[model samples]
Target: MGSLTVPACVSTVLLDIEGTTTPITFVKEILFPYIQDNVKEYLQDHWQEEECQEDVQHLRLQAEKDKELEGFVPIPVNEAEIQQIIQGVVDNVHWQMLLDRKTTALKQLQGHMWRAAYASGQVKGEVYADVAPALRKWKEAGIKLYIFSSGSIEAQKLLFGYSIEGALLELFHGHFDTTVGPKVQSESYRKIADHIGCSTESILFLTDITKEAKAAKEAGMNVAVVVRPGNAALTDEEKASYPLVNSFEQITLHPVQ
Candidate 1:
């Protein structure tokens, strides 16, 4: 595919993680599985910490709200034994993950687990070959950059901070997660622009999801649909509606006059 020329109005770029910068396989084959396999041991190791306990409490609350759903796992509220409560939280996490729910409770716990994993060198964040160099070029050009992903902010930090590229966090000005709003919501894009102290038109957002591209467009931001291996195929209509790039190197930023 030909290169994508970003408009001169763009002063900031917001990036998506899963399928935009990193391969979907890294998240599916590595990150998520790590949580499922190690959640039990992580809980046992960190249960005494206030932060871990707080994560457990959040899960308990989310579990309470989920009780009406069929096949919902329950977290023990007043269980006598610590082991029983831990077991309950573990079960609830497994159930939520199995169903691929993105509740804050689930993300909070997952983020904490990933932090330890990254620190201990159990996992390293993956990025495409062209991502770092392209980002460096943009930063040197005085274009600000930020990340917007469904992953928790802490998780985002861990990924970039311990990335295979080695601490690429310096490349970003900030990060946003679902705490701001769902990625498919136009308002989220607007809120991000506001947070960055820039006009929506001055920010370009890149994602593999057409819904996210559409939403950012609605919010008046420039949008690009990233095409990467393992990303969902875009429809003909989607291809017509948005700029598409197979790699960051394909995107050339035009300086503002």
Candidate 2:
């Protein structure tokens, strides 16, 4: 592919993590399992603390909302019952119930637990071969690169910094997590533009998901849909509507008008 035309103003590149820089299965399977296996006990052991109490409240509120949304209601319960309920929610991958207000606590705790696994050689972060070299080349060309992922910024940093190829965080200028907003929402991309102090048109958004690319495009950003091998599930219309590439090597920045 040739360089894309924007206004003569593009200056930054914003990339997503899972399925873009990292494999999506690692997140959905390995990382989520690691988090789920630990959260119940982490919460149970830390329940008396103020932060833990807050997270419990969030879990309870989330559970209630989730039950209601699913056309059911949670019964009022004792502490033990609530613990069992929360554990069940996590185990079943009821993300709507487990990942909301205060989900950061669980994600952070999971990150800490995962550190040992990564350090002791039990796990390694998976990255596509194209990502690291492309990032370095972009950095060398004086383009500012930022990470926008659903993963916590700390988690993002850790994944890149401890990558199988080793500390690649040096290439990224900044990171954003769900605290900014959900990846599929236009506000998230807007917030990233504001945070970067650049016009949305000056930033190029790259991801494997169409909805996310749509969100960024709605925020006035140019979007690239990365079609990594056997990783994406784009619908038929998606194949015709955007710049689709098999690797970052296909991306070439054009000077904005």
- Could you estimate the TM-score for every candidate? 0.93, 0.73
- On residues 110-181, what C-alpha lDDT tens digit does candidate 1 reach at each position? 988898999999999999999999998999898898999988888888999999998899999999998899
Candidate 2 residue 110 C-alpha distance from true site, Å: 1.8
Q: Model 2, stretches more than 4 Å misplaced?
A: 1-8, 36-102, 254-257
RMSD of 2: 4.8
Top-TM-score candidate index: 1
**Cα deviation of 246, candidate 2, in Å:** 1.1
Compared to the true structure, candidate 1 yields what TM-score? Answer: 0.93
| Residue 180 local lDDT, model 2 | 92
Off by over 4 Å in 1: 77-79, 255-257
